[model samples]
Every structure is written in structure tokens, then in C-alpha cells.
Target: MNDHDLLETYEPVLRFAKSERFFPMAVEHYLERCSILPSGPLGAAGLLFHLNEPLATFIGKLEGGQYFLRFINEPLYDADA
Candidate 1:
């Protein structure tokens, strides 16, 4: 079988709870809604990209350090409601 067919055959199914408010989304949409942060011990916990920036621009700003994305600037769902 081809690589694509093989991988697809082995792909696992995912189930989500009915109460789940979030699901997989496009990287562009996710990047626009989230902020980038530096990870690891030497990396300070701060916002590296706080605005709706593109993935290419964000990658260019990386300085060979471990980094992660956070949805701190916005809420995925209204928990207080």
C-alpha cells in the first residue's frame, strides 16, 4: 500500500465529550487567536507574539529557543456564563 493509504488505515479515531467546546482548527486561525511564548528554563514566560500574526512571521521571530502557543489573550469558551 502507498504511504498515504497505510497511514490512513492506521489513523486512530478521536472522540470528544459533548461538553467540549473546542476542536481542531486551522493553524492560521489558531495563530491569529493565540499568543506565542518561550519555553524552557532559560526562556522567560512572556508574550513573544501578542497580535494576529501569520505563521511565517512568527517562525521568523524564533531565536533557536523552545516555544509554545497560548490562548491566553482570548477564551475558547465562556466558563463564567
Candidate 2:
């Protein structure tokens, strides 16, 4: 995706992350780390972060205990499951 599209897509996620109710500190912590990482890995992390719980749970069925962790930790690993 283009930079503008990427930025636009993250707008809502950012808002949610900032909100006190849905405030997941781990996500914010990861964002801080992601700032220094290369774009590709950051993008993958961001994609995983945006996945809702049900979707994340579904992805976990792909031979990983958690989709977000697996996706970010082993992105290059075949997603074949």
C-alpha cells in the first residue's frame, strides 16, 4: 500500500489505541519499538495488530498459539500452516 493509504488505514487504530477504554499498553509499547524497525517488518506488525480478536483467534489455528505473535516473530516463515 501507498504511504497515504497506510497512514489513513492506521488513523482509526491509532485513535483506538489512544483511547483509555481500549488502551492496550502492549500495542503502544510495540509501536514505540516499531518506529526504529524497517518498514516491512513494521508493516507486518501493524497488520497483525489491527486484526480483531476473532480473526486473530482464527489465524491462531494456523499452527501457532497466537497469530499476532507468530506473524511478527516469524514473518518470513511460511504462512502455509
Candidate 3:
């Protein structure tokens, strides 16, 4: 799945106190990193930092990293799931 698709995948669950737009920003960061290191493995922490303060707290920095790690590495990953 491409980085843009992450928006659609998380749109329903994505939450933000400041602005919903921050979510897309985070997704863009993730996508950018992926493009730079397509073959290299990724962690959510890399993308999570792009999020604003409230959004970062909502997801929990380290926890967010774990989530991305699992989703990216899992055989059958589903953002909605």
C-alpha cells in the first residue's frame, strides 16, 4: 500500500485536537521516508514525530512506532484493523 492510501485507511479513526490535516501530514512523512528507503524497514517513530503535540500524545510516540512496525512487517496488515 502506498503512503497516500494511509489517509483513506486511517481516516475513520484518525483523531486530532488541533486539526485533521495533521494526519495527512504524518502520512506524507511516512510516504516520503518509504520512498527514500524503499528496501529498508520502517518504524512509526520516524513518521510519528511529524504529528503535532496532541496527535502525538493520542497515539503515544513509542507505541505508534510499534504499530507501524507491525503493520509494515505483518504478512496481512490492515490499517483499519
TM-score of each: 0.49, 0.18, 0.15
Q: What are the per-residue Cα lDDT tens digits for candidate 3 across 1-81?
A: 888898778766646787453345465345433322122235444544545443323433333233432123334436657
Model 2 CA deviation exceeding 4 Å by range:
13-21, 25-63, 66-81
For candidate 3, the per-residue lDDT at 75 reads: 49
RMSD of 3: 15.6
Q: What lDDT score belongs to each candidate, Candidate 1 first?
A: 0.65, 0.44, 0.42
- Candidate 1 local lDDT, 1-81, one digit each (tens): 999999999997889999997788776777776666667743443234435556546565555577777766664656756
Ranking by TM-score: 1, 2, 3
Compare candidates 2 and 3 on lDDT and give the better one: 2
User: For model 1, how big is the CA root-mean-square deviation?
Assistant: 5.3
**lDDT (Cα, 0-100) at 9 in candidate 2:** 81
lDDT of 3 at 80: 53
What lDDT tens digits, residue by residue, belong to model 2 across residues 1-81?
Answer: 999999888876545444464344565454433322223554456446545444423332343222233224434545765
Residue 14 CA displacement from its true place in model 3, Å: 8.7
Q: Is candidate 1 or candidate 2 better by lDDT?
A: 1
Q: Worst lDDT window (10 residues) for model 3?
A: 32-41
